[model samples]
Each structure stands twice: as structure tokens, then as C-alpha cells.
Target: MHVDVIPVGAGHITQDIARGLLTPVDHAERLKTYYGAAMQSPTDDREMIDVPQLGETGPAEDITSQLPRSVLTGVIQPRIEETLELVRDYLEAGGFDGIGARRVVLTGGGAQMPGIRELAQTILGKQVRIGRPCRVVGLADATAGPAFATCTGLLLYDQMAPLELSDERQTEAKEQPKGRLARMGRWFKENF
Candidate 1:
């Protein structure tokens, strides 16, 4: 079995812009529209963003220092740890034999964190790596980052594991003969 975890904000770089932290002219700009510099268009793709209001003079120094760390620990890290633990416990219960019999794939924006793969390895005690989607046009650079992993993987699955029904005939002894007597007999046999 192959398993992949996609981060919550997997495909959206737009949230970073609407919060006033990033300029529209940035790479994420393509994801947003501008009504002047201040009024930015909302993005459906990005994870919801909440920014504390800043006065004209701007935020305090200490507040800025704590912001990134707070987001990492409170939001991003917990989600990763939770997902990894659940997967580990599930695989163990299913009798999956260690790293060789298992593959844990992590994808999504959260997986792009600098030390996350190492952190996941320490916790999961299994090999964990990023997922890359395949078989789509205009996706050469999509897998370069974790944000597009799920969408990419979906495309890849479409290419590799195209759905098909089994061609072999199935012999169900009970279902093979269909008639009123057969049904009545089967019912009588089961019931009696």
C-alpha cells in the first residue's frame, strides 16, 4: 500500500499576499487581483489567513519575532505529528513489517518546511518522502514544491493506475443458479 499526506494549504500561495506581508508583484501575485495596492482579491485556493491589525506605526518588535514560530508550532507542526502518528499506529495494527513493507509519503505545503522530513523520520521510524504528481501538462515545476503534491499525485494515479474491472470470471456457488426453486431452496437451507 502507498500512502501520501498532503498539507492543508497544499496549493495556495495566495494567503501570504492578502495579509499585507507580501507584495502583489511577488510570484504569488499571479494568484491574486489588486484594487489598488491595499484592496486585494480573496483566493479560494489558499488556506484561510488571519492577520492581527497593525497600527500606522506597525507591529511591535517582539510580536513579529514570535509570529513565525507560533504558526509553526501551534498549527503546522501539530498537524504533521498527528498525521504521522496515526499512520504509524495504523500500519502497525495492520501487520505491516517495518520500513521495508511500508512507504509513508508526505506531500503538501506543510511538508516543505526545512527540517520536517527529518522530524517525521525521527517520529515515524520509517522512510518518509515527498509525493510528486505526474502525467499533467504545465506541471514540470509543480512538484518542485510540496504544495502541489496531491494534485500532482492525482494526475499520476490517473496515468499509472487507470481504473479497470477484473476480466476473470467469478463463480459464486450460491449465486450461480438463479431460479425460483433455487432461491426457495437456498432460503429454506439457510433458514432451516
Candidate 2:
């Protein structure tokens, strides 16, 4: 099952706090760094050779190996630890009991992060997973990844809404018996 993981910003806190603190630029930069770090997977040179078969090929550094473990453990891991703690708190506080959730979805481009789902599951204690758009008629390739999930979901949402008043009025007009005056108006509209 596909899952959508939305981004959390200062806005996730409270509107007042969000408005008081981070600006749009700050929020954007935070999201960029969060997503960038999440996508970075540790791989040695040997692993790089195998990646080519999957369409990934380039000079790469094994971040896990290259970075000092002390620094990573002190800084990186702590941040992840903090975030996970926050997620746990949020879920408990919000009361999101995992009922009928087959797979927890993490969507958005950020969902592509290498081990985020595992981290999230560990923290949230749920059957967590990532979600991607799939199996649409015209939007097959366009809605392929987590990044496109929101847009694809929105398009699907629009399709499911009831007809507007304008549409209902038009349908009513189509179904009604046309008097001579209405026919004359229709003829004039068509000719014009």
C-alpha cells in the first residue's frame, strides 16, 4: 500500500509560533537540508559499482565512512533522535491510533530519504512506508514519485467533488422543455 508523508515545519507547532519564528526562506532552507540529508545513503566504493545497474552512476563518497563517527553520533544522530521524539509526541498528543493502516506512507520528495521510513516506524511504532502516485490514465509518468503525490492527490480530489452550481444550472437548462423564446435565444447564441 502507498503512503504519503507530509512535511512538518514550524507551522506544525502552532500558527502563532510558526508566524513568530521561521520566515518562508528559513522554512524552505530547512526543508531542503532535511530532504538532502535524508537522501544521502552511506555507500562504499564497492557499492557504487553496483548502483550503476539501477541507473545511478557517479563518483560518490560513503558519507557514513567519510564523516567522523564522533561528530555524526554527537550531532546528526541526536537531531534524528530529537525529531523522532517529536514525532512520537505529536502522534500521541494528536491521538493517531494506527487502526487499519496497512502500510504507513511517507510521500513528498523528502520520502525518498534512504532510511526515513525505518526511523519513522521506529519512532512512531507503526507499520510505516512510503507512498508514490501510480496507475492513472493520462498522468502515468508525471505522477510517478513521492514528490508528485500532493499534486496528483489534488487533481484526483478535484475530480471527485460534486458539480458546481453553474454546471447544475447548465444541466437543468439542457433537460428543460424549450419554449419558443428559449429556442430563439439558443438559435441566436449558436449563430453568434
The CA lDDT of each predicted structure is 0.50, 0.49
Residue 137 miss distance in model 2 (angstroms): 3.1
| Residue range 40-125, candidate 2, lDDT tens digits | 34442123211011112343222112222222222233345465576666555555545644345666655664566777787677
RMSD for each of the candidates:
12.8, 11.8
The TM-scores, one per candidate, come to 0.47, 0.46
Model 2, CA-based lDDT: 0.49
lDDT of 2 at 50: 11
Candidate 1 on 1-192: residue-level lDDT in tens? 755333434223344432334322232233232111111224322334333333324442223221232332333344455666766776777777465664567776556655567767777787778665544676676456667877766777777795663544343543456889988988898899
Return the TM-score for candidate 1, rounded to 2 decimals.
0.47
**How does residue 192 of candidate 1 score in lDDT?**
100
